[model samples]
Target: MKVLFSSWLGEVVDNRGKPPESWSDCPAVTLPDTFGKDRPMSAFIGWGGVVVLNESYDIVETAYKYAQALQASSCAKCFPCRVGTKVMEDTLYKILEGNGSDSDLVQLETLCGSISSNSKCGIGQLGPGPIKDTLDHFKADYQAYISGGKKRPNYHYPYKMTAPCTSACPTGMDIPLYIEQIKEENFAGSMATIREASPMASSLGRACFHPCENNCRRDNVEKSLAICKLKRFAWDYENTHEVDMPLNPNKHTREERIAIIGSGIAGCVTAYNLALMGYRPVIFEKLTRPGGVQLTGIPQYRIPLESLDAEIKFLEGIGVEFVCNVTFGKDETFQTLRQKGYKAIVLATGADLSKGMRTEGEDQGYEGYYGGIGILKKIKYENAEIPKYKTVLTVGAGNTAMDCCRTFARLGSNSYIVYRRTEKELPCDPHEYAESLDEGVKYMFLEAPKRIVAENGKVVGLESVKMELGEPDDSGRRRPVPIEGSDHVIEADCIISAIGQDPDIFYMGDEPKIKLNKWDNPVIDEDTMQVIGVPDVFAAGDCAMGPETLVIASGHGRRAAQSIDQYIRGEEIHLSDEQIMENIIRKIGAYNKNEKVPNPKGWERQPIPICDRDKKLSSFEEVELGYTQEQAMEEAARCMRCYIVGMACVISDSEGGE
Candidate 1:
């Protein structure tokens, strides 16, 4: 974390002339000492300012590259940002070319001020701050370059454009761009931008736990924009207008066939992307219907079957083939798939097998004992009749538990959620928790299921233990400890265990080639999503990353597809420069919750419409009513477009000098 010089956000720490012992660290800023793996970074220039780590780096050329980066990233929304950044780049290029002078320094300073004052967005306003700092603190280096006394250093400057919400998103979605498209009344354009990262817009628009809104800059003003709702608006617009979904022009152009072993979010996303890249992808589902757990584990009230079906139809239109009732280890082994001409295999089987409660009488086949996911499958896929039980107690606090309890409540049962922690520590989304309460689903906090109380092979009640929160555990949540002599029985006819899920890779058989972690999930290279030591086999989704949100699973799917493409083409499986820059910025921290936004308040966030409480509880129907066109536009306008440019000066061995 040591720095030779820094002017980040005006918290200056100049240790250029001091010894290592006497040098002080900058309190205002912190950066990773190394870039990717062990590659040391000499300097980092961004919207804030510059930080010099290695003194040997040519400060003049670094500044010039930073300026060039800014110019290249400019959106040109305004006169000052567009023309001003170009002028700044030209002036720096002149100085780097060994063409004179002292007057140009003053001109550069003036231009920086103008761009900062008049630019429309962060790229224009904050991009000039680093250049201004360099001119002030590293003026001697610039003068040397102009005086023909210094040589340009050979280094590679890789830069990328990113926004806070975009960087925080699991898919690295261009959030601001889509919102801007909505503001411009370009619904199709917004969908196009979203399709760049994911093709499950309709499904995700409904079921995704949107992490982007949590880091939105607009939260500083009043509240975060309705980002998830805005996405739904775009997809709904396309659907309602009967607009023909565009098919990938290069679909099925490639000869190699790829086999994806699940129809869930991860598998579908991978197939969609591969099809777009002209590769023929075939998705295999063991169940009679596709859509994987998204159709079975998740309740119909959250994501309707019709909606998911429409998304599947779109994927089919793009040249993805689906085969139902086909099992992996049973019907087709990894070796057989390769023998059958499948160039690659993706395992996205998902973690649908419910983990045990580790209590007594739970595993025994009792009349009313049900695993959370098992009950949901019977209700959704099998259309099981309503249970006659009056009381239903579900254990766990995740979204799955909420769905189970809420679904039971809708079925006229007295549903209860039992968790070891307090309501404040609930792991489910805030909205899901709130809605569960509103639906008459009760909660028993500070209670953990001890044993399943059954009579004559029929579940009757659940023996629970009072719990107290102790020190934080590895998951960063307070560990729950049972209080002595605090056991009690919660009388109920039905007991459901919704604690957690593990990947059902039983399909992998006993002697699988792919490695698995301690949790039994497939172990793959985190960056490439390729199975460790098995180049032709890739894994993603709940099967690879335990249990995660749909967005994160989709991201894994996208990255795996990219790696598969490179592998088939006989190219190196590596991240692009833009993806590398994304990792760098993410490590540096994108959304600053403490940072103050200059915009004024009073633009309240538009509220999304929902189905009536009584009507929604009467049947399994989609809850959210989505946003109207007027509401969507108003919400989109609240986006600050908080885009920032980040550049890294890597020590390259190439001879080119700029």
Candidate 2:
């Protein structure tokens, strides 16, 4: 094979035995350009004379070229590069004179390190790069000159690393490792692998939005793999069939007792991970039953109570204490918690306050005009007189609004969602909106609510005006403009407002102990989930991040747990949001391998099944059925093992290192 290796100095070698002088005479061409990108060839031409390092080449001649290159390139300014390069040249000439010693090889490595690290210019600094590469990959060539009898080993091509989906997971679940374990029919092993980073595997499997699937490499050919469902399949298998939740491999006693306030996904996740780390984690819940938004905020049909219960039970089984019916400020304050022997406190009380339409007649106190979240919470925790409303008008096009409309429909009430924007601009999940439509829930888009008309202190009708699209707003969606003289009145017994909600800091009290943002939320170092300036206190979930998805909240919980653990252990205290992102990015990784690993081609994403429309509307049951074992194995096999490739090529130097 023809080998052409050249540095900036090797601009002289242009495939000719002699060096090319003028630019016009021999145009500069890359090594691959001289041979071919697909061909088997290697070249190393540095600042001067070329030394082709292919096994078929004459090493004596190449050594002479390397010596001449080193000799011609010594600038007298920098001590390391100027003196080191000349010494290297003298050593090479000694080797060429058949008088080199073992000490010469040691000196070469020392000089390479000093020149690479201490050089002033790019020419001097990167000059040892070729030697570094040679020492690492072609060290035998140097050894052959020194010792004797050097037979070239058989050719072997390096594996190319590639995995996008693994890097996409927020929890960094070692997606490819679990997938590979599944491919081998090792369901138990797969679950163990998943439990390394994420404890809410079952919950995530059932409800995660799966950012990983969106970035799946398979999407280039067919659709993305059913990654979420696959995880659910493994979790379902492990939970229902195998021995319950994952256990702590090494259990030890701990003096540090951490307190996490809130029983939402974030709070629960933090407690679970901390418990695994051998710390006593106690979660305090204000509500009667824990599972903050998971129990009350989210509808039963979307997330079953039993699933949440079983997951929480797992946490309890692993020595995590759940103290329900305890309000943070009323029962235990920040100072009180510390006094009670809790080393650190994690505030993950999620944003539960539902926003109002803020239109006319909103403050007049009309009867039966409740917040969408409040209505859902009531319906979820206990059955209220929902059917008595007869006609429900929900203002907002979010998932909460959809849930409200669906709940009313199940209770045999006429429900309609009045959205300011069109269906195309729906903020809710598309599937939720579509299912609501299927359940006979009505929609009135491009009709902005102006006010709630009342009769005898009761909501009787909703007054709305037709709206038109205008310029884009801060949200990047076209602004809705109300049309003149297009006012209309829709008769309704109830009006439900579900615009949005923020962190309600009322529980913190007017005294204001911890620092708060302009929005009244706690100011936190987003990377560490630590409350800024409050060492022993940390925050997570909706309260910290102003209402994120369940998966995101859980991720925040994990980070908050990390921060709390670090703080208690007297580790690095502060981290900026960018550092938090770097930590996640490093764990998830960018590219598993430089080369794209080949996956099974032309396979369509397995379709997820849902309950029959009649059955779905009649009762609160899980809608999307999880993947079967056979289906899961097939999907798991299609993973292409990108993360395994990444693990195989784990950089010894640093992350992103070659």
Best by lDDT: 1
lDDT of 1 at 618: 83
The estimated TM-scores of all candidates read 0.97, 0.72
RMSD in order of candidates: 1.6, 13.6
Candidate 1 stretches with Cα past 4 Å from truth are 20-23, 26-30, 655-658
Q: Estimate the TM-score for candidate 2.
A: 0.72
**Cα deviation of 588, candidate 1, in Å:** 1.0
Error of 2 at 325 (Å): 0.8
**lDDT of prediction 2:** 0.70
Question: 223-300 in candidate 2: lDDT tens per residue?
Answer: 777887887788788778846455665343686889998998889989888888889999999988888887887778
Regions more than 4 Å wrong, model 2: 1-162, 242-245, 249-252, 510-513, 574-601, 644-658
Q: Compute the lDDT for candidate 1.
A: 0.88
